[model samples]
Target: RTYAGLPVLGGDLIVHESASGASRSVDKATDADIEVTDTSAAIAPSGAERSALSAAQAAGDRKTGAEDAPRKVIWAATGKPVLAYETVVTGVRKDGTPSKLHVITDADSGRKLYEFQAVQNGTGTGQHNGKVTVGSVRSGSQWLLKDSARGGHRTYNLKHSWDETKKGSAFYDADNVWGNGKPTIAQTAAVDAHYGAAMTWDYYKKVLGRNGIKGNGKAAYSRVHFGDAYENAFWDDDCFCMTYGDGAGNKKPLTSLDVAGHEMSHGLTSATANLEYSGESGGLNEATSDIFGTAVEFYAKNAKDPGDYLIGEKIDINGDGTPLRYMDKPSKDGLSYDYWKSGVGNDDPHFTSGIANHFFYLLSEGS
Candidate 1:
């Protein structure tokens, strides 16, 4: 609508006299127009699916048309119980992010309430005590690396394949135990990836008060061992998953805790401001990832992977003990700028991001 106003419902009948026809008559709704027959409250949001379906069946499929549980409500005008159901219709949002809707219905009459969809922020939350634990399930006799608690955030084995489109199989084990203190085995890296994801999810939920990466109660899956010694980790919007490469010679998997947090923050940024990945906004984009990544690492004080402001310290992308980017002194990388200059935006985002990274560091920690 152009603007919000009083919505007029079903008032079409109007007649004008032939002689001196100025404004003759209009048909208005009376008490009988909205009289409720069954004003009962028997069905709940769960069981109200039948009523929700009956209400929304005209728009979409009879069974699946009810996007959410029906909501019960009384006609405000009549001050009577006229339960109506408002279900979320099918459609992706403008930014292409998924939409969610909930519904409730009257208990007795089974009348559905009004349907609606809204962008609810921080709807879901996670709990991580900074411990090395995996949320998994038993299948037949094996335990799969799946986090049932945090929206089923799972880690898969790409088998050193480069196909990002394919979601590799789960890292299953006969015993629930995983890893042996090395990245040689597939499950070893899977644990790192899965655990890192859990920590990041927890950081966002507990510290930042976000539901998930998208703030939509959904988890982005992780793909480990994406390529042969690929030496890279990336978050793809298309796949909506984190892909980690086995570092040079397949010795190191780029599944560090801070790195996971950093990657997921990109999705967060996309869902929010959607800052363009170019110019000053691009640098801010990269800096946002680093900031939240470091925050997540700090929030998650796991002894194995302790918190630190240094980004990507465990992955060793530089072939030395040094991390990828330093927030305190980005110039240490030899390519990043310590401060923003007139032409800083022309440089690479990772390099130009040093300015913001340095600022966040100084602001958070002290000069």
Candidate 2:
């Protein structure tokens, strides 16, 4: 039972019923001397909503279009129980990804306490895992580049604009065969991305006995050509989408098969273990993605981009004709650690991930 929205547990007391129909006294798990000083809210609901919106906007660097009214609740997750407000703010981030931020605030002080984004991230199209079949939808005698077989997973062209509020146009073709195997054509990158998503979906389903990234048998979408000369791709948990950017000089797209697997694996990690993206946990998180990405590539058996232990080998992000990181000998990249050591958490996750990456390589292929 709650008192003034604060859980007081049977009005500061709980009666236990014995199997014999006898009543007994049990500890209520709260201090007996604790007093309910303020049963009413000091700040209005509007003030709480504003507090949440302000914090969401500041963190996302964009204006929130809508927000749910604050609801009075008990904030007893930690410390003394206190009256608090929970608000949800919705907006589009600066990177053209949708955001649904849940914010909690102190009821009396209206101070923001907690907030989390709700979108997803991933890989490139300028470089892909070679030729592969993709699911498409037919409408009005035209083939739309959509994965109807895989929960209607679709790809959109962002046109280098960060406006996720409005989805860009879907790629279409008469022949139903997409892409010319070159990044010069926009459809080329889209084809690669779509194919990669399909392959990743299949890898998880067929090999791991998992249904989808979230294990709910639902498909997540992808967005390509995100920004002008954008050099990276990412997943947004709020939007439940993966976005890719055209690489340097707009010549390379990062949508390789392993890249797709790598980015999408981040989603799986979020859904499962939810490792904190910092320090040792963060390194493990990144290494998990790399390990599964390599698994997906091998599972794909794509001839053009043969499966290898090298991550981002096709994208060539380094421009020196070297893959982003190596698993067999992680230190080959001169940044990632090849073995576990003390204080490895002090390094960035990408660098710290090398330790586990090397370990996986050894475990799979042997030293």
lDDT tens digits, residues 1-367, model 2? 6665455322245688899979976656565433456768899999988888788778864758445677777655455767778787877668644466777788889888767654322222334655556667566578777775455689999988867554677887777766767877888789778878888897897689898898887988888888888888888788888888888887788888888888889899999999999999999999999999899899878888888999999887888779999999989998999988899998999999998999999999997
- Residues 1-367 of candidate 1: C-alpha lDDT, one tens digit per residue: 0001212222223455657777776554433344345545455555666555554444343224444444444433333435443345443334322333434344565544445443221111111212256667666567777775577788889999987789998777777777765765777777777877877887887677888988887999999889899988888889888998989888877888888889888888888979999999999999999999888888877776777778899888889889999999999989998997898899899999899999999999899
Model 1 per-residue lDDT at 305: 71
| TM-score of decoy 2 | 0.65
Cα displacement (angstroms), candidate 2, residue 229, comes to 1.0
Per-model RMSD to reference: 16.7, 21.4
**Candidate 1 Cα errors over 4 Å, as ranges:** 1-131
After the best TM-score superposition of candidate 1, give how far the Cα of residue 254 lies from its true spot, in angstroms.
0.6
